[model samples]
Target: MARIKLSCERGRSIELDTARTALGCIDFQADFVLPEGRAGALGLPIEVLLAALPAAQRALSAAREAGMFVFFTRECYAPDLSDLNAFRRQYDVAIGSPGPLGRFLVKGERGTEVIADMRPRDGEPVIDKAGFSAFHQTTLDTVLRVRGIDTLLLMGYTTQCCVASTLRQAVDLGYACILLADACAAYDPADHEATVRVMYSEGDNFGWVSDSQRLADASQSIEH
Candidate 1:
């Protein structure tokens, strides 16, 4: 595999060609990205996530076109916070704060629903998680292995947390990981930039990060 390395600004442009399978789209919900979700309407850049919707969809399409698996993971706790851990339950998030316990896009909540822009295609994985790491309590890893998935193309919200956590685990599991930098957003630019810097500078310790276009190009060339 010819690994492409970019500058630090861009995960050092590490070119990793692996037997990639799934594309993990995290926290792509209305309350997190749309204006009507309360947060976006308040001028939060977390709301600006919708801006990346088109690119995310494009990347997803490309991955699908390449015959890879598409997976969606969300942080949805039980109604009584039964499934939530101390970290997520630390604060009392109101119903609309984008937190699963306090309030959020849960299993059947309209707010928890996947944004219309990035609807799940047929046969894609619509996974559910309660913590920062999707593989923690969920069947994500086993599911991926069952499908023979190796490489993971990650995209989602809150770059410093969920996305970063997932990246580290993916690498530790021996699965090649590629972060969709442009396709993902965070509550703040500082956090987003910090996460990306760590992924590249930290290198294999945290997994690799890549841009949407490069991933799209690679997806296009992949022979299913």
Candidate 2:
């Protein structure tokens, strides 16, 4: 477990009114979460599962009920993963050609679908990204702007990579971002802690960070 060494880490109740929007990203895709999920994927699926699906759902539900402008994003390119950069293509080959994961998430394919239990509602939008950051190629910012969203609540997989990248950019773009420190999972424990420490060190201006339970209660209370 990653213990908090920073004195600034404060626990708070949830308050939804403090922000204009909340965004949740890549919540343990089946291709990346469950074994059965990768049944027909083209590439080998993700490793380093956190086995915390239930908690993630609760956090998501809290965000939704709080009436925040809930949003979601995931990694998937168009057919053949062509929308992905060349580096990802090379990754596909190494993971094994014709693998289920590689074949799935080929954009427009059923395999690329978000995990069933946590699928977004009709009103929610899913941003497709080839690279790590959801803002890299997608019009997420445009949607955020249109929706009058200025803050985001992010959670998901691979804490050190995509999650961290998303956090950094979200801050850079002038949006208030709160990361559910426990709601996310990563490939390595050290990497996870390192990422959190780095983000925390970035200072209070970057955003607030907390555990899923704190955020959940806050959301339930519609508290800030």
Candidate 3:
């Protein structure tokens, strides 16, 4: 696959091809983005997550309007814990055995479901993933390849974890990625800003970075 290089220089105007691009919302489930969800109950910063909602919604809507393939991802595991990684198991156990959220993203649990505001539409796929990267043990790559997607616009909860992980892997897999900075969040504000800075600093190394409004505007604009 050939690389579609774009400078991550500040104020650069990016031309996104809808037919070759897909918008991926990563780990936007209730458990991670909601104020009363597991992350909040565990004392992680819920404010940042809440602040990201509007931006995420705007970007998602724009992606849909632009006729891009929209993919939503949630990090989930089997109820039997068979799919749980050792680190996740340790983290879950540390968090009081998942408390009321069903052991760290157990499938079919209410918390595992995508938050209502950003729920998948009729034919969109809600890819269930077992780890941070959507491509890890998941069919995301196949899905994108089958759809002929070469570029990805990504946004979702947790800037430093799932979102970052997916972006890095996507670049390695030959996908041009643009991470919507304002549409994702981290527990710590410092971490959130830092991650975005790194992504934007590397040009096409990991991926490019843009704010939600800029991406939304680009997506909604006419390509011709």
Candidate 4:
């Protein structure tokens, strides 16, 4: 297996073995990305989140071409709110409330599904998580381990929230994480920038922060 090195912030870089790496598309659901979804209804700028779609799509395609494991995650709770935590319930009144796209963040709802453009293909795992971190009470870690995936390239909506939480957890669980900066978005550009800065700070403590283009180029180089 050829190892591809990706440059990171603060003069850092990380190497990945494509065969042991997976692409994690986190919380790219309609509720977060679409104008008619929960985020837009809550006054979050969906357009800002939508901006990352092109880069995400490009990374998804590159990962597929490189034969890297691909997986997606959605932040949704059961219809009855069985999986909803007390903190989340109190903090966000819209967790299970009705909205334009069915109950907000509820499973089996249109808003909970991944958007059309970034929908997972056949055999790709779609993990439904109730919490911010994909590994929390979900099979994400197990799925990765079962596939022998030790490195992850994470991309998706809300860099400061779900993406950051998942990246921290992935690092704690011993996975070498590379966050595709351009492939993620936050409601505020500053928030996105802050997350990226933190990710690469402290000697790349949380994870390496890189963009989709660099990843694609590195993977393509390895393929040749």
Best by lDDT: 4
Q: Against the unseen true structure, what C-alpha lDDT does each candidate score? A: 0.72, 0.65, 0.80, 0.89
Model 2 CA deviation exceeding 4 Å by range: 1-8, 11-19, 37-50, 90-96, 101-104
Please, what are the lDDT tens digits per residue for candidate 2 over residues 15-83?
344347665765356566656556313233344454556667777787666666666777776665457
- TM-scores for every candidate against the unseen true structure: 0.83, 0.80, 0.89, 0.95
lDDT per residue (tens digit) for residues 1-224 in model 4 = 66778876667788888889999999899988788887888888889988899999999998887889999999999888988998877888878889889988899999899999998999999998989999999888889998899999999988999999999999899998989999999999999999988975766678787888888887788645
Clash-forming residue pairs, model 3: none
The residue pairs that clash in candidate 1, if any, are 3-15, 4-14, 4-15, 5-13, 5-14, 6-12, 6-13, 6-14, 7-12, 105-112
C-alpha RMSD by candidate, in order: 3.8, 5.7, 3.3, 1.4
The predicted structure with the larger TM-score, 1 or 2, is: 1
lDDT per residue as tens, model 3, 90-161: 765632246456655888887888989998999889999888899999989999999899889898878899
Using lDDT, rank the candidates from best to worst. Answer: 4, 3, 1, 2
Provide the lDDT at 184 for model 3: 90
Q: Number of the top candidate by TM-score? A: 4
lDDT of 4: 0.89
Better of 2 and 4 by lDDT: 4
Per-residue alpha-carbon lDDT of candidate 1 for residues 75-121, written as tens digits (9 for 90 to 100): 77676677766655677465334442225645666667778888897
Q: What lDDT is obtained when candidate 3 is compared to the true structure?
A: 0.80
